[model samples]
Target chain A: MTDPLLSVRNLRVTFATRQGEFQAVRGVGFDLGRERLGVVGESGSGKSMTGRAILGLVRPPGRVTADRMELEGQSILNLSERKMRRIRGSRISMVMQDPKFSLNPVMTIGDQIIEAYRLHAGGAKGQARQKALDMLAAVQIREPERVMAAYPHEMSGGMGQRIMIAMMLAPDPEILIADEPTSALDVSVRTEVLNILDRLVRDRGMGLIFISHDLNLVAQFCDRVLIMYAGRIVETLSARTLHEARHPYTQGLLNSLPRLDAPVDRLPVLPRQDSWRDGGPVGESLETDLPGGL
Target chain B: MLSLALTLLGLLLVTFIIGRVMPIDPVLKVVGDRASQAQYEAAYQAMGLDKPLVVQFFGYIGDVLTGNFGRSISTGQLVIDDIRHVFPATLELATLGTLIGVSIGVPLGVIAAARRGGIIDQVARVVALVGYSMPIFWLGLMGLLVFYGILGWVGGPGRQGIIFDGMVPSVTGLILVDSLIAGDWAAFRDAFSHIILPASLLGYFSLAYISRMTRSFMLEQLGAEYITTARVKGLSEGAVIWRHAFRNISIPLVTVIALSFGSLLEGSVLTEIIFSWPGLGQYITKSLLAGDMSAVLGGTIVVGVCFIALNLLSDLLYRVLDPRSK
Candidate 1:
């Protein structure tokens, strides 16, 4: 890629707990072009924290630092809150994990989408409403006008997630960071949501940071995958070669999943190794190709 | 609607049972201990005490439904008339107090939540603690001493100053409003001055509760994932706090505010006594002391109805404010 949409090097997120300083994301680095870049890790492995840190959403006592965190060649890390807010929805936006808790229960779907669009776009109410309806239709919601007047509780989980996608993409952001967007959905609905997201990203030629713990799903959906282990990127490989990963942690994760073709009596538990925490990092240095850098 | 009617009926039944079962006798209260057997018998029959309890209850319910609450032995006026005259005084005071409380409390709470663990939060906590724990009568008395007794900054005692009493026509039974209608600026000033101190004291008490609730509600909402979404949507912090979080809390906050208002209306007995304000609290207390069961039961019933009405109002508001309820 001529110049990646987002570039980060040595990003770290720290939280001050009663026991001591705890590092959530340590020395994590990546580059995002107009492609689906997947960050795969188990719970507490810092994939979610990385997404929040990039959006400047981390609350107090949780500090984020990066040697170089830029969005399209501009340093975005640690910008003033007012300035950071400008870049948030318009330049780069985030979709939370679950739509059930992600949409305001009181607001109408139209009002929420309109509000989100107006916050960044700042146009007339009619224009915002028009834009909201268009966005809803873009996400393939039937009866956009009727759905707009309905509340979050009235919609199913799949519809709610689609509404969320519509709202997040309404501002036309350069990059969309979706944090486990389809985890709360059913298997059938999950594929539909991913398809909508995939189509939008490709249509807009926007960079996407897809965060998930489903390794196989990431391999099938993402162009590139960053395997995280204990707050650091242990491996970076093209999604096609994810199963053939050399890292012991990645291999352990893959082995833990029960495969249908190879019917096993008992699925193997991942026996974690101590070296995964602070071992020599497996990926190449910052200066490398955007994808398939390994 | 049926539940509402049933709830009120149950409330009236409980009050009626309590009145009848109490040691004080209604016939004795009217005929007195020295009355002859004939007078006592006549009074008992007139009071419907001689009839079956079931019959008496139905009679009382009929009387209440038709707006006849009987006559007050203490005030020598009809029970309905007495309530009509005095309830508004308490209504005016409580409304003003609640207005003061909600206006100040909500913003204080939002600020405290936004700056949690900061100086403003600490101040709000202390204020709520003091207002919640402090005795209202003592607060009223102190208010009288500093503002009325010492500084003479406000009118002392009663709903209006002696000079302005009965000067304005009883249009709405609210002196402040009546004075305004009469174009009696002097009376309005006197009524306003007299009401301010007591209203402020009640307002302070309510503010404590409102602010505490608002803060907790805001904190919970602030932590919600939707709030994160709002922030990520590039909304100004003010918009996120006031428009999104505050709007969500308004549902529960309505209940808090309505309950506080209702309590202030019926439960301002201490403030009324300290200030010698001839409101419902004072009216009920005076009648209760004189063993005037007619007046006492009537006042109690009115307060209960008002409480129920306030609850109904809040429920209606819940439907208006929360989409899920609808």
Candidate 2:
């Protein structure tokens, strides 16, 4: 099989707090090959940290260490800032959780999209404008011209997220790390945004790292799922078999969800166990059997 | 425009009331304390001080609007004419000082914030601290001692050298510009040399505030999520900081700059005194010392109007900088 688009092994992120070193992401690993890979975890469970580590967006005082982190077989771990910048928006881009905070408010949407594209795909502004319009249209934004001239505050939450997606995808990155891109939108708008993202990723054949806490949404949207607990992946399974997850933590999480088909008086609470804190690395052994696995 | 008019009216009223309530009698100041009671009464009636306070306020506002600010007892000239002569010098000094402050302070602040906790940041902090806390009069004296007295790098006190003094015709009332207009480069250099030290002292004073504000505003912008997005877009760190973050802070920074300029325009009294510069500050200071109510009240009103105008300018800039405001 051809090599995966991106690969990682034994990724760890540590933050030095007043209470000593806190490992936010510990020994996490995965591979992506033009497919939707969902990372599901509770808040503070390292899902977002993993995405930031890949982008080298972690500020100082927070540390990221990994045995191997590669994109197309090239070591991307610990690259100098200059070298990493060329790869970032060109090869791997990120769509943050909320477009409200992610988009520069003072800048016009057109300028922002054009800036993102021109930074990586050096071209005159006229060419960048055409590219930006095309991107806005690709994200199904009506009246790309008006949207381009508009500011972030002028757009709705859904529209803002779509613009963010357009900006991130304008350079045609090999991978798009979407950190809860739809979580900020209304539920009705969430499906619409996800559909746009799904269609774009499929059409572009770009690997997607969909970081979210919505178990049911991830089960339906992603090709495979990684269930993280305490910064470590406790379960890795096909999205189709998410309900039949093997790990007790995954099973408990699934059980805790409220279901309409089989209604219960009360959803069972997810009981914790000490052993799950240092669970064996299930990610490595199960990496090859998934639907899109190499 | 209506608000501006109303604000000016209010300022005139306040100044008029303060002048009346203060125990320093304008009539006594004009006719002298030893003048006979009949002479004092005649001067008071002539000056319209015998009218009710409300009538007097409206009278004062009317006079201000019509460009009649009464006659300066000290200068023996119309207060309006005196302000016209003295104000331009202050305008020139403050404008130069503000220019110096903005150019150095903004870049320094940006660098300090961008490098936060680095050597540049530490140095910026120290500079800002010194600028903020050090007394301007003392700074001016030290500047004079080092640059003028000891080193002889700059011309000593006053607006120009003794040789060039009053050489250039008063076309704009700004010595530098007036000298240039008259094609007198020697006078211009001397004027600049004399103005430079005082202006630099004021510049250092404003720079402390501007840099400190810029650093804080930059620090806030740097931590914003959009800044992170810019970095993720593969822009260089410089682009991320200056283009995106600095651009965002510039709106509020305009207000900082405007307020600092306004303060410098009116608040350079000490600098003017130390340098013996014949700017509005010194004019107002001398008027107040000699109990010249007309000149002092007129200067106060002018300073107040300047503050309001600067605020209006900053508001206009806010709309230009941030479209959301518009």
Candidate 3:
């Protein structure tokens, strides 16, 4: 087996608020090889925090600590901000939720792409521009030149998302952390974006941490899945075998997803248990507790 | 463009009407009370003020279009010529003032925003508050007392010292430029020293407003998601600020700077009065008190034109700064 591109262990993120130190992520860890790892969780589940912490992009008042975090076996936890900046986009870039806000409104698409390229790709302006254009085309943009000069507002959600993907991938980062890259996109374009992402990762042999709340999409798209609840990874399963997950949270998540084959009367709400927050193995007991027969 | 033209026309008509309705007789003010009634009649006739109000307004509009602002009753010079001469002085002062404001204020604001709630931000906020609160006249006086009377660090008020009188030729009507054009560094230094205190005082006012605006603008830009995108691209914090973030703040700062410059042109009246500097604020005030209608209207029109031009320039600048604009 190939070595993991990135490995994280016992990572925790705590925010110091006016009231007290509130821990958001606790002892969450994963190893990302050159494969798609989908982190599926609902809002406030620390999925986005995991991605941001990996990139070292978390702002002040939020603290991140880990026993071990390595990119290709090089220790990343102790690196200074200046040193970490060298690795951020050139090696591990991020795609945020909203492309409309992620893209600089005043700047042209060409300028933004060229800026990203030149930051790490350092060459002549012409070379950087050529690389940008090539990357834009690589992302399946039909009219590269026209889109290059167009501003962010001029593009649609799909086109803007494509442009964002092109920009993030331009630096040829080893790992791409896409935090809900398609949640803002409509259903029609979501699959298109997924296909593009799949193709790019396959062709480049890059690691991807696909953070999303869409369980069905993750099961359909990714190679492996990590189910998170209350800042803990409750279950890790092969996407092919996600339906066979053992954890109650995972089972609950799966049972909650409305399947077209069953045609249920109503969608089941995820029952909350105070003990579930501990994320211990209580799968079989809760499995029988579910109203629908498994 | 049509609306702009109408606004200018309306401004001129209103000022003209105000001048006509004032209790003082413009002709008597020009000819003097001792002059014969015939002399007063001739002076009014010469100005074509004997015509109907609408005709007189149209006539004034024609003269204004031709760059003739009529004769100044007090200064006895063409109103256009007075503005042309005196404006550059104020321009030189305000330009330098605004330059100081932007150069220092913008960087200070950026730093304060980046280090928000830190000692530097606290210091900047306190300084801005003090600067904004202090009256320009008191600041000007205090500056004069320390820099001029006490330390002898700079020359006393006016465009230049008596030594530079008739020495530097007026090429651009700006002493600094004309002195440089004449290759006279001594005259330039002398001119510079005389303007230093008043310009600094005016600059303090601009700096306060600009720094406060810049701080808010930087805070807004820094919080934006694009800043995160820039960071994710491995761009340095400085690059993220100066390149990505600064550009965002710059668009709004341009409007602020332009408006401040426009207000400065209306005469830093307090700065002018305290420093005994001869500019439009002092000119208009003296003319208004003496009820010199031509000087008053002409000065008002010149100031109005300047304000409109600046506003238009700022609007045009928006298109250049923001590509989202059509």
Candidate 4:
């Protein structure tokens, strides 16, 4: 098989708190190819942290230490800010959780998209502008011209997210790291956004890291799934086989889902014992001594 | 725009009421204490103090509309004429002060905010603290002593040197412009020498205010998501800070700068006194003390109008800078 698009190993993110050094992401790692990979976890599970670490977007005081982190063939961990900037929006781009906070409110949508494109493409104003309008149309904005001239506040949540996708994709990055990109949108538009992502990846063969907490959505949308718990990945399986995941954490997560057909009196809760914390790699077995009752 | 108009109208009404509520009699202020009863009655009648309060208020408004602000009992000149002479000088000083303040303050603020917790930030914080806390009158005096008395580096006092008394024409009433127009470099130098120290002193006061506000504004913007987005867009750190963050922060800075300019025009009274610059602050203060009601009221109105205009200008700037406001 050809080399993966990106690889990470032994990644640890820790914050120095007053109490002590609190490790947020501990020894979590993965490899990504030109396929849709979803990272599913609850909030505080460090799934977003892993996504951010890939782009060096993790802010100070929250340290990222990794044994190995590479993109294509380059060691991204130590690249200078200048070199990293060129790679960021060009070779790899990100769509944040909410467009309300992600987009610059003062600027027009068209100008921002043009900026994203021209920063990497180095084209003239008219060309860049035309390209930006084309991107707006690709994102299925009905009135691309009016949307381009509009401000972020003037647009709806779904429209804003679409504009964000357009801007991030305008740079034509090889890998798109979407960090819960549609969690802020209404349920009605979620499928439309997913369709856009699906078409982009299928047509362009661009690799995707879809980070979200929605297990069912990840199962349906992504090619493979990584189920994380306590800042560690406990299971890695193809999306088709996610319902049959081996780890107790994954089993507990699946059990908690509200099934439309089988409505139980009380949803089964995970019998979270102390030993469950020490489960090593993906699909690793429980401790030798299981004094458990679930 | 409607808010601004309402604000100006409200200001005029408030100041008018304040003047009327004063316990001091306008007749006593105009006529001598030992003046005859008839003379006192004549002065009262001439002031229209004999009329009802509402009638007098409307009468005052009519006179104001017709450009009659009464006569300054002390100077014996029309109040409008005094404003025409003094307001231009005050405006020139304020404009210069604003220029100096903005030039020095904004860069310092950006540097301090960008390098937060570093040596530059520490030094700037201490310097800004001292500037804000230090009395302007004291700073003005010390500046005068060093720049004037000891060093003999600038003109001592007044608007221009006594030597340039009749050299430059007063076409614009602003000495610097008038001198340049008259093609008198000597007069220009004298005016520059006289103006620089006072302007810088006022500038120093404004700089402290403007820089402190700018620092907070920039600090907030630096943490905003757009700044990170700019950085992620392959823009350099300088571009992120100046072009992106600075633009976002400048909306609030406009208001601070404009308010400071208005106060400067109302007169850096202490600086004016130290430099003896004949601006509106000194004019109004002297008029009030001498009980030249016309001059005092007229000066008050002029300063009020200036504040309103500056506020309106800043509001428009905010709309232009942040399209979200529009």
Candidate 5:
């Protein structure tokens, strides 16, 4: 394609701990176009770290180093904090995993959303507030006015996530990173949040990085999927080919998931092999021998 | 709201009764060994001590309502007048001390939390530790020696600083107010200089508690998901910490500060003693030593009132800051 909107090359994030320098993301690299890309991995697999590194939000004691980290063809690694701030909400935005702790507990939903809009828009309070209301409506929130005035604690988890989505979209960022955005919501509300996000990404033609551990959901929604294990991306493939993933870790994860249509007497467990360490031949066979119940 | 008021009223009544019935006979203690049993009984009867405890409590409450706290046993001065003279000084000291505490403590706390584990944070932690560990009396003595003796930058003993050097004491209380009323700049400067040492000593104690509370509060807020969201939204580190994190953490800090304010008003007794600042703590100390029943009772009531009032204020502030309290 004509130069992806964002490109990350040889990205590594290391956290200094009592044990030693533990690498959380090892040589992870990806490019994002104006489409949905999903990074699926279990907790501590470094999917969240990758998102944070891209946004330059990694704090002290946790270091991020990349040979090439660029956004819209411009290198973002060396940008000054002031310049980085100008790009943060305007060009790139992130929605967190839980809305309960993500949203300011004391501030009204409307004030917070308007503040987010005005951070980049530099408009009057009235205009910013109007934009916030419009964003709430865009997120399919009914009675936007009432919801805007509500505090974070007053709203349900689903409603809070919707509000968070509205706020993130208010700045009209070119790229949006949603880290387990619907994981905290009920199963019934999960699809609703995902649909809202999907519709918004398509309408705006924005690049989206959806981070989750649910392969089925990612397969259905994302164009491309990256499977990660132990801070390393073991496989990259088109979502349509996720059922035929070639990485042992990805295959193991898929086998672990309960299947609805399968009528086997007992669910098959994927074989664990020591050679699967560091993505080797035993790992390679694990990906291919999936149907045989090996 | 009515229930809250009733609860407060009940607490005040209980405190008053306890103050009265505390085993030590106020009349005998005041009159001393010269008085006979009959004389002691007569004095106690006049003071309404022979009446039933409930009857005596109601009488005291009624007298308090009417602004009659009886005459001081030591000086025979009206208790109300003693309070009027001393309360202003105590309030001025408390206000200045709290201002110093909050202004210094909040910034120190925010910076320490922002840095997390740097040299500045380490230094702040050390200072907070020292402040908490040092007794008010010891700190007061050390402050006097350093600021007044070694430095010699301030006034000498019995001079009461640069203020009131030549100015007329128009108000007889509140040196700053009297100085201002007389339009005496030199007196004002002197009065302020005298105020600094005592205010700082008290402020240091308050600062210790407030900064510790604030640091923990900010640390919790910094780890919050919204802070991450703020950073992702392109806001600078300063904006995320100060604008978003600071506002969220203020409710708890405010409560700590209000409670500290109440403590300051009760007076940092040692600080007042060292500087000879005639505030309520010094008054109460002297009254207790001399067995001055009226003055002691009056001081207790005033201090009690201030403590209760500050708590109420903190509750109101809590509601204002977090609308979820509504």
Candidate 6:
């Protein structure tokens, strides 16, 4: 079989602190083809760090080391910052969680997107602007001209995210990392953003890494799911098999999420365990103690 | 815009009224206390200080409109001519001071923010601290001793005295201007040598403020989400910083620079005393001590105008840098 679009192996990230070094991500491995891969974990579980590390955004004092990190058979770990920059938007892009702070406040949306396109394309200004308008329309923004002239703060959250999505997709990268992209939007706007992203991924045949803590959303949207806990992946399963997860942590997360079909009087809670290190077999007592079977 | 205009007009009116109401008896003060009452009354009438306060204010305003500021009691010269001779020197000094301050401060701030917590960043922080702690007067004295007295690499004792034997008065009150007018390369070199120590001493205080403000502004911008977004776009570190981060941080940095420019224009009295540069700082200090009312009032009005003009310029810059403001 051909190699996946992106592959990571033994990825380790450590941060130097006054209290000594602490590993944020320990021996994590994953691969992405032209498919939606969901990474679900609680806050501080190194999920976001994994995304930032892959993009080479980790700063000094926080070190990222891996035995193997490649994109389409190109060794990403050894690339110089300048070369990596060339690959960033053109080959890989990211959608930040919040549109409010993600967009540059001082610049008009059109100007910013046009600049983003020009940075990679080396095209003339007018051509870049036309391309930006086209991308805006692709993101389902009606009256792209009117929205282009508006500053980021002038647009609503949903509109701003659409503009952000438009900018990110302008370069047509092969891999798109969406870091909780819809988390900050209202419920109604959240589905719209997800749909836009889904359409872009499907049409472009790009690899999508959806980072979030919501299990239900990930199950519905992603093709494959990785359940992370305490900075390590505990289980990997097909999205269709999420309800039949073998790991207790994954099952616990599933149980914690409320379902619309069967409203419970009181939702079942996960049994507390003291030494629950990830990437280990589920304990017998914890498995047998589950309130319900898959 | 209307409010700004009205505010400026009100400030001018208040200055005029306050200028007339102060009861120092300018004639007696300038002519000394031993003068008889008749002599004092005659001197007051001659100087037009004997008129009622409101009348004097209107007369002053009318005279100003007619391109006159009356006469100086100490020198018996036209007030405008004296100001013309002195103000240029002050402006040149202030401009040099601000330029030096910004050139040094901004880069230092950028480096500090970029290498935050590193050795270079630590040193910058320490240097800014020292600059802030050292008083302008003490710093001026120290600068003169080190750069002029001991090093002997610069001029000493007199204004523009380091390289040139004596003053070469030219069309411009500023030495650099005069040298350029004279087309004398040697004089230009001499003037620059003399200006270096004094201008740097004056700039140190402003540099401290600008560096601190720039550092904080840069820190805030570095934390901004767009910076992260820019990084993800694959822009190089330098482009991410100078292009994206620098432009955003300029809003606060511009305000700090403008305010510092206003302070520089008011003059660094200690630096003026140390170098004996005939700028407004020295002029105002001498006039105030000698009770030269017209000169002191002229200096005050100039400083006040500097503040108002600087504020207006900063507001305009705010609009330009942030389109959202409009």
lDDT of each: 0.91, 0.91, 0.86, 0.84, 0.83, 0.82
lDDT of 6 by residue, B13-95 (tens): 77676666677666666668999988888888887776787687778767765647656666667767777777777788788
TM per candidate? 0.97, 0.97, 0.91, 0.94, 0.91, 0.87
Give DockQ: model 3: 0.72
Interface RMSD of each: 0.6, 0.6, 0.8, 1.4, 1.1, 1.1
Q: Candidate 3, which segments miss by more than 4 Å at Cα? A: A245-252, A281-294, B23-52
**Native-to-model Cα distance after best TM-score fit, residue B13 in candidate 4, in Å:** 2.1
Residue-wise lDDT of candidate 3 within B180-259, one digit each (tens)? 99999999999999987888777878888988999999999999999999999988899888888998888899899999
Each candidate's B-chain TM-score, in sequence, is 0.97, 0.96, 0.93, 0.94, 0.90, 0.88
Better of 4 and 5 by TM-score: 4
Q: Which window of ten consecutive residues has the lowest lDDT sum in model 5 chain B?
A: B156-165
- lDDT per residue for candidate 3 within A19-101, as digits (tens), equals 99887888787788889999998898889898988989877888999988899999888579999999988999988888899
lDDT by residue (tens digit), candidate 4, B34-55: 9999999998998788999889
Record all residue pairs in model 4 with backbone atoms less than 3 Å apart, i.e. clashing: none
Which candidate do you rate higher for TM-score, 1 or 5?
1
The per-residue C-alpha lDDT of model 3 at residue A118 equals: 86
What TM-score should be assigned to candidate 4? 0.94
| Deviation of model 2 at B321, angstroms | 0.7
List residue ranges in candidate 1 displaced over 4 A.
A283-285, A290-294
Model 6 lDDT tens row, A77-111 = 84778888988888989999999999988778888
TM-score of the second chain of model 2 compared to its true counterpart: 0.96
lDDT by residue (B1-326, candidate 2, tens digit) is 78987888788878987888877878887888899999999998998888888898888778888889999999899999999988998999999999999999999999999988999999999999999899988989999999999999999998888988778889889998899999998899999999999889889888989999999999999998899899889999989987899889999999999999999889489999999888899999999888888899999998998999998999888999998986
